[model samples]
Target: MTSLALGPATPAATPRAATPPHAATPSGAAVPVTPAAAATRRPSEGSVHSWDLSTGVDGPGTRFVTFLSGCPLTCLYCHNPDTWRMRNGRRTSAASVIAEAGKYVRFISASGGGATVSGGEPLLQPVFTGELLHRMKHELGLHTALDTSGFLGVRATDALLRDTDLVLLDIKSWDPDTYEKVTGRPLRPTLDFARRLADLGQEVHVRFVLVPGLTDDPADVEGVAAFAGGLGNVSRVDILPFHKLGEAKWQALAMPFALHDTPSPTPERIAEVREVFRAHGLNAV
Candidate 1:
């Protein structure tokens, strides 16, 4: 996704793919792959607090939402401004988080969906996410999923992917300029993340927010379609119609509303975006 500074979690804004059977191996020889730098980067010296786990239909069968704190991105429209501060929340050890998640093991077992480690950038706490996912999968037999921007480095990503069964990957914008404008981050990292996931043959659901004017450029949409379509492992593309539900969060945080007057896209625009995905032969969910 574009820079984290875009905004909070709203109805419209929220947060990948595979190759083939014999397609994995190269014809002649295989190029050795290395983990991403972000994965290897030293864990943030900051601590993490685990919020109470809850249920949701957002992803998987039933989600035990694990809200972790601390974020590096400054997306202006972020709804979870409360989660941005590194020191504002209480700390919970990885073991504690896993234990609590285990409490709902029955829920997960019955529903076929398990723990969802969310942000303020869950990848920021790679070790914690890895440990939690490991426990849930091996001990609890839970179906693990990651809700991430896919912008994290390979090192951290490798750890997180070890126990991850599915990924809810967000692609904020395809235009590098718009991506920088929205997230204050570069676009290549996110694209690289997607490519890496696809290369690994992971199950990914590509999500794009239909932000009026900002993310609606034909080139941008087409670019996203082209990228998602190229990934043989991508199961679906979800076009989320952007809404200002997080407008109140910006007020609560006293952040300026940069997208205040921007209304949700019309039915026609949503249809157009769906058509773009359909044209690419992607299942637009």
Candidate 2:
């Protein structure tokens, strides 16, 4: 994810009750609240890594992007390694996140941008993610975008999709084995999500990180391009060149930087990849 301003973590808030309040039964006995009823009363909370302001790269104009914590896939080129664990993030409520974004509402709208709920993987906390999207769209009246790998796409409810104006879907790789090699997870879920988005006519920007020797194969790139093009809902394809910007973070976390020696794709290579997407009749940037 591209960011201009990296804000400090939001202060942790008081925790909620573990059990719901009991209801009085018709026989004058206290009855435990039903699971469904308790859910409605529970506040939306999630593990937040951090937030930042970015332009052009994240989505549309300038955006207030929230980076939620926890992800299923362990991508070789993940820049935010610190966000891999949910426990590493600060516990905060959805209202607090909205309040933070509300501070930049006018500025974001003026730039033709909106709010993006990104992650470690936003879908890791579907209820909280949905709350952020719904309030950001309905309350703030801003365009909403979800930046995700689509691995947990099944968790996103239709209500959440309805509130989302754009989706920055990262289709890391196309070939099943290659995808697994790049993300340490299967590719079926993401492809399934893409098809679902197409069926819903959802607007999407397919993001692909071009890494030399890893995902630079012409056949693999072609597969992604063809799939995104066939979706009919993908408005643009973003061919991002791999970089070692997160190398320092990995070292700080005491984790192996597997791609430490991997060189960024050359400008020529990047242009070639873009041309592949263009051949599919989709806009590439």
Candidate 3:
């Protein structure tokens, strides 16, 4: 419980490159480690795809964002396909990642930002996620946000939420069948997570991508608006226009790229979808 809408920023992309060969930092703490630094440094257990210091679009302000690996969902629009499997990236320790984040903490805190642990799916490594969030809040004295599909919200422990200040929950589709088709995952878990988060009074931001042929239905958008409106903790809603920016990633992976020809939704269509949320008294951007 405690999920949806962390903030309405676009979550724009910078495709992650393959992890480079590693050499230690002279401290001998393993140049590459695993995250959640949750337990003993079990090298290779927790992993990360990549991390970058970014601004204006991920969370509230500038942030040190880490993208993890091993996702249950296979969304067609996912640009971080390289993060689909944990093995694709190097094992990293939470301490190491946080230390790297420490470099930008001052700048981030100055602008009211913190850290975001995004994914292939953060919930896939709950312990690591919980520990990472805990440290970001307590040790670093910074805000913490979790960006997720809410698909694995069940994995989030109370300890994890205690460390989390916001949740960026992406609701891929409102209709169950369509949601399944879109994400290759069930929709119930996300809805369940959203409800629990609201009940817990946790802050959340709902995000939806407006895909022309797939999710442009008036009923579908309206359905999402209705559900999000019912959640008292939702602070805002982001309307992301679908794009083919990830086509190359798919091609490189040799996976089918059916959406290559799928055009982004028209401005009018996007406006219409935003209106559905607005009509439901949501702050759709």
Candidate 4:
């Protein structure tokens, strides 16, 4: 689940022009639009990398996953290195994204799936993300999920969180040092976000990638499992085993793959890690 291949871009939806509330008077005088009304007419736009359909990996069922571009963390094992830069993405409006997702509303609804706003880091463009989530839930009549590292949790507004039905939070590592090593960032923010989600009673699925020699330490895994278990909002824990599916991506980007020599955890090791989560009274998979 840590690695998602970029899919084809959805056909562009025709951009709709915003209608100004102010009208011309018979005397040909124009009325000034209020600040609040102007804000409403402003379309939320973001840099979108790509989007794809996936089942069981993004959320509950098959989901219309939107992968926004740009991330603060340069994870050693990041698969989509192509999405690392915001400039690499195409500028897209939230309305266009919703229009694309709307096409599949009936199918997604029937399958018990919804829409997931994933990223290079969706929080990088919080305003656009919130718009997509809001429309996806209210307009599309679908469950909405946010796939985030939670590093930018502070950017998420309460209104944004209100629209999210579930959060697929990735706790790359539990130990602060290890977390920093795995992702060139601190761990406190993610933990803080988790706590906030717990307080808000937001549904969450904790995703942990088990990288050998880096994040495979039982204590570290236990640290994440324990923290997630303690958070009453965590509905399930996904023990994502590290894989080289994104190795070709790194090679294509000409970026050094630090874990090139590292091997994936065996089935038994994966099972063992899952047991650690189950021990903490969490539904681990």
Candidate 5:
């Protein structure tokens, strides 16, 4: 679910969540809860692209995956380019989102799972994302995970991470030049955010997409593995093999398919990469 945006034609069926009484305004203003602000800051809505009641992939067990719209990065391998636009999604309230997750909380919790908010970078909508996670943890007592590219990690607040149980962080590349080439964004911000997450004792699962030539350089892989290992808080490293699944998405969107003809890595290649991570004493899969 990393590169080449999957502009799925699932129809705008998912609902978004809204603001909390104590939260700041959407413009980052500190406003008291007034009738006007309440209506404007309505806790009943968020910009949600789609959702899925998933298992295994999104998080630990059964999960309520809410994919929000809007992202800053234009990764060459983006799978959800459809999510690249901001607020181009259905608006639902916080209550509505929680309600949907509530329907599966029992099954999720029973299997040591919970809800994960992903998107074109969830941090782009920090207020909505934070509020939703807070409720998921405090109100429903469900484990919460955030799947993000970390490009907008600076927008994340302390309160938000407190509610997050785990982070599915996608580290696109190691070298600054290559990172920028892979994603139309810099790498330091992501590294800074990863460091911050580690400093907070938050659990993190490092997700790396292994592109055939772009990111297969041994130096790049070693750099990432070493850096991740030093963090101490990284629980797992998932070396995802590159695929053409999202090529159709790119073509459908009329976006250039740079890696259109790229082949997926073989099992041995993936294992070799996994071994690189393991060499750093990391748990790789």
Candidate 6:
């Protein structure tokens, strides 16, 4: 596909050198803390968890995004393939993560934002994501969100939705065969999870990656719109433009780039798809 820019802006690199050690502030907190304070405070081990922090970009307010490790389905276009392996990531405790996340609570509150747990399929690490959200809300009083494909059977439970303030659910495709082709899995479970979440009256923002020749199909778009339209708890729909941002990552990891030759979707096409969702009364953004 055409060039993609996923995640946040990459920071400038610093040359490694022998120098004095210093403490670091938690990335994307609502407020900045002194280095001295960070150094004096014991870093919470947070279960040695594996998470890539994104300071903003995926919820109602300012957010500290976490890329939790592990996923059940192997979506061919997944950008973060490295997170698919559970054992490959760190295993930090919830307490430690909250302690570190707490350093940013002031920033979150001031900015009207909080933390988001995204993943290779965060529900794959339900206990971890749940525990972290629980602590963030109870201990730190911060809003919590979850970004998930909602494909796992046992992982889509009511308990998981309880701690979550918002659910960014990805609907890969409406057609089962096309979904299998794209994600190497079935579609029923994912759809079921969405409806179940909605039935429970949990707030949800439905997301669909606008992939040309795949998810852009009128039938697929219409199906998604119809399903979402019927949901009582679905508050909005987000149309994500597809891109090939992770092509280099594939090369770096010695993995094949499935969409290496695919072209990016045109602006006209994205607009047309947005019109479809708007027609269905689903707020498309």
Top candidate on lDDT is: 2
lDDT of 3 at 139: 72
Give lDDT tens digits, candidate 3, residues 170-217. 998999998998899999999999998999999999989888878888
lDDT of 1 by residue, 167-274 (tens): 878889999889888777888888888888888898888888888889999999999999999998888888988877778877887888798888889999999999
Q: Which candidate would rank higher by lDDT, 2 or 4?
A: 2
lDDT of 5 at 162: 75
Residue 282's lDDT in candidate 1: 95
Report the number of clashing residue pairs per model: 23, 0, 15, 0, 22, 16
Residue 250 deviation, candidate 3, in Å? 0.6
The TM-score, computed over Cα atoms with residue i paired to residue i, of candidate 6 is: 0.80
What are the TM-scores, per candidate, against the unseen true structure? 0.79, 0.90, 0.84, 0.90, 0.87, 0.80
Per-residue lDDT of model 2, residues 1-285, tens digit only: 456776756864534423323433334344556788887676667899998988876889889999999999899999898999999799887777778888999999999999999989998887778778888888899999999999988877766788899999999998899899989999999999899999999999999999999899999999999999999999999999999988899999999988888999999999999999999999999
Q: Which window of ten consecutive residues has the lowest lDDT sum in model 1?
A: 14-23
User: Each prediction's Cα RMSD?
Assistant: 9.6, 6.2, 9.5, 6.8, 4.1, 10.0
Candidates by lDDT, descending order = 2, 4, 5, 3, 6, 1
Name the lDDT value of residue 169 in candidate 5. 92
For candidate 1, give the lDDT. Answer: 0.68
lDDT of each: 0.68, 0.86, 0.78, 0.85, 0.81, 0.70
Task: Give lDDT: candidate 2, residue 226.
Answer: 95
Compose the digit string of candidate 5's lDDT tens values, residues 206-245. Answer: 9999998899889999999999999999999999898777
